[model samples]
Target: MTYRIEVDQEICVSSGRCVAEYPERFRFDDEEVAEGVPGAPPLPDDATLRLARACPSGALLVFDAQSGDEIDIFGT
Candidate 1:
């Protein structure tokens, strides 16, 4: 299943990791916080998880697209 990714600006550190790694999917807002690009193609589940885990500030969040349930990347 496809996954949805979001950036929590409140938690975002503006490291630019997501913007650099996935320019088509993410971009920095006026305040320099990372945000997901609207209408961007969805990422696969594995890649989505990897992206969430790679966020240094834990700003990236992953969700089950169909279920709208948040995925706990750090959970067992």
Candidate 2:
């Protein structure tokens, strides 16, 4: 299974929550926007969801691995 994590660089506020919670999967780039590391091992679904929800600016998006649908962690 594969997962896709997308960060809206324009909307990101450099909160660092995603990197702090899942360093192996996310990191802050030179511009300070959270970036998903390519080829990183797939993280557990719950962990992925948590990281997406942790983004205070709601810039992180986690796609369902199988369905390719966006997971709305905040129920918004």
Candidate models: Cα lDDT each:
0.89, 0.78
Residue pairs clashing in model 1 are none
Q: Model 2, range 23-74, lDDT digits (tens) per residue? A: 8877999988888888788777666667777778889887777899886776
Can you give the lDDT of residue 71 in candidate 2? 68
lDDT of 1 by residue, 18-70 (tens): 89989999999999999989999987778788889999999998887899999
Clashing pairs in 2: none
Could you give me the TM-score of model 1 versus the true structure? Answer: 0.92
Model 1, which residues run further than 4 Å from truth? Answer: none
What's each prediction's TM-score? 0.92, 0.79
Candidate 2 structure lDDT: 0.78
Each model's Cα RMSD: 1.2, 2.4
The 10-residue segment with the lowest total lDDT in model 2: 42-51
lDDT for residue 46 in candidate 1, whole number 0-100: 81
